[model samples]
Target: MSDTLIDPPADGPTERPLPLRPALEAVLMVADQPLDSVALATAVGHPVEDVVAALQTLAEQYDEQDRGFELRHVAGGWRYYTREAYAPAVEKFVLEGQQARLTQAALETLAVVAYQQPVSRARVSAVRGVNVDGVMRTLLTRGLVEEAGQDVGTGAHLYRTTGYFLERIGVSSLDELPELAPYLPDMEDLEDELERVGGFQTRPDEQPGDQPGAATPTEETP
Candidate 1:
């Protein structure tokens, strides 16, 4: 029998595998959504159990170090979040007396959109108990939220938070959004009120694109 020689394909690029931890970190660092163990494992060519173990280890390491940030599981997946202890410093740096900031109403509307994205304008307005047409337009102009697609049932346009929104918030993904339940009114109650008030009946006549505005940082009301 003769020896067989294997030749590399000339037209294809070579593939290199990275070390498990660094590979996981690199992917998580830029991910705009919470990647599960299976997804991470597939991306890094590692076993799902190994990816899960690595994530747990990383979380523990960060906690032991008292780092300003933390690895957290939220919305059913894992991502990074600023440790509560460092929120003040982080906020000061991010806000920086920026004369322009989101208004309270806009902020509230944005939170609803961020949490319930791929949601229709009607649903958003319903949740907020107010017409969100203008606020949604503002969010779109600022590149914080975007048109996701049309809702199959109503044929209404759906919206979701943008990757830019995650970047601005210094979070890797939506899963990292701080828990709002403790601070805000009960969402179920709010939704019930919205329904009773018939909030979802009305919608913006103009589509998101028809709204006119320049993207600019907002100023807090005095």
Candidate 2:
């Protein structure tokens, strides 16, 4: 989906060994984001078919009996990340104790993005009744949300949660979010409900079965 580090193949397949390994490593390294097979192939000057085979090989190598990291496809591209089992050690020392925390503003902005993903910043602001510029910046920095693309009408940047968001939220997919219906309030009772919650927040342990982010019924009227 994005530019990659592999070089385009020469005019023809020369006898020289394809730079498959280095090409993959280069694509994985210094990539601002993940590298998809098509992009990697384009970059490596090899056909996408060949690049894909090489990737499988690399992935299998990492999945061998012993390996510190694994190649994974996330956020629509491929990247090498440490295995989950080593997360604690990596977080405690290698990462200098940095852990992502969502601020109230970030959480609110994230809620809007999650519900109306591929949504423009303008739409998010309209729903939240507050400026979300700062919160959006934080989410981008934290790798929870990213610019999906530009809107068609005004060319406004669209936002969506990244794969990392699912991992952090302990959800495998967006469809896993709980369904909300019974918790929704009637039209006349909108303000009172939000007023009571102090701007709704879900408890961390709340499972997928719990109703969350159920805005008042009036908010549901298109």
Candidate 3:
């Protein structure tokens, strides 16, 4: 009896290469802004901890390189940026004619929405001291604001900023929104504007918070 021996194929699975931390670093190093661990994890299909460790390692390497740029954690994530010392030089190349100047109406509407997200058009109009229908359209079209949804009580469409806004402003989320106090007029000064427009208020004697009518912006990127 002649017995023939057959070769068996490979086992259950082929081995894959381990995750390369340096590759992850290279990807993030060239990004315009910081990347969150979640984003990195998704890209590499690895645990967030792994991605974070890789980022930390890469950051140190860049530091040791003494390049004109470094990694920084901002808006609840990490991003590569030019060294502060090279700001002037970098600005000359990146900021030339690339700056976007928001219109007054857009700014006002954005301010209202940023402060009072999920706010309705009527509320924004109430705070701006003018009809905001047109301005809301502009903000939406410009990708600065979007419809959050309908309010149960009035069924009015709620509005908020888009991811584009977060990226545009170099923030990870609305929580990172800048404090409006410095940019906003005081309650006493805004009284005329508020009364004339007829919007909600945080307190009888204070401006509304960053909510529909009252709240504040903090660094809580999602």
Please provide, for model 1 over 1-222, each residue's C-alpha lDDT reduced to its tens digit, 9 standing for 90 to 100: 769987779878766767888888777765544667886788788888988999999999999999988888777677778899999997786556343687888788888888777776666665655566667766876778998877775566788999988998899988888887355444344555545545243333223222212221223321
Clashing pairs in 2: 6-43, 6-44, 7-43, 7-44, 7-45, 8-45, 9-45
Candidate 1 Cα errors over 4 Å, as ranges: 1-16, 97-222
Clashing pairs in 3: 34-78, 34-79, 115-210, 116-211, 175-218, 209-214, 209-215, 210-215
* lDDT tens digits, residue span 115-209, model 3: 77777665665556555655665576567898887767545567888899889889897778778736644434654554444333322221111
Q: If scored against the real structure, what TM-score would every candidate get?
A: 0.44, 0.39, 0.38
lDDT tens digits, residues 1-222, model 2?
878788768776765545886777776754545778887877677878888888888889888855778888888778888888888887676344226456676777787788677775545654665545556656776678998877665455678999999998899998887664234333234444434433222222111111224332212210
Which 10 residues in a row give candidate 2 its minimum summed lDDT? Answer: 202-211
Where is model 2 more than 4 Å wrong at Cα? Answer: 1-100, 180-222
Model 1 earns a TM-score of 0.44
Q: Residue 12 deviation, candidate 1, in Å?
A: 9.8
lDDT-better candidate, 1 vs 2: 1
Candidate of highest TM-score:
1
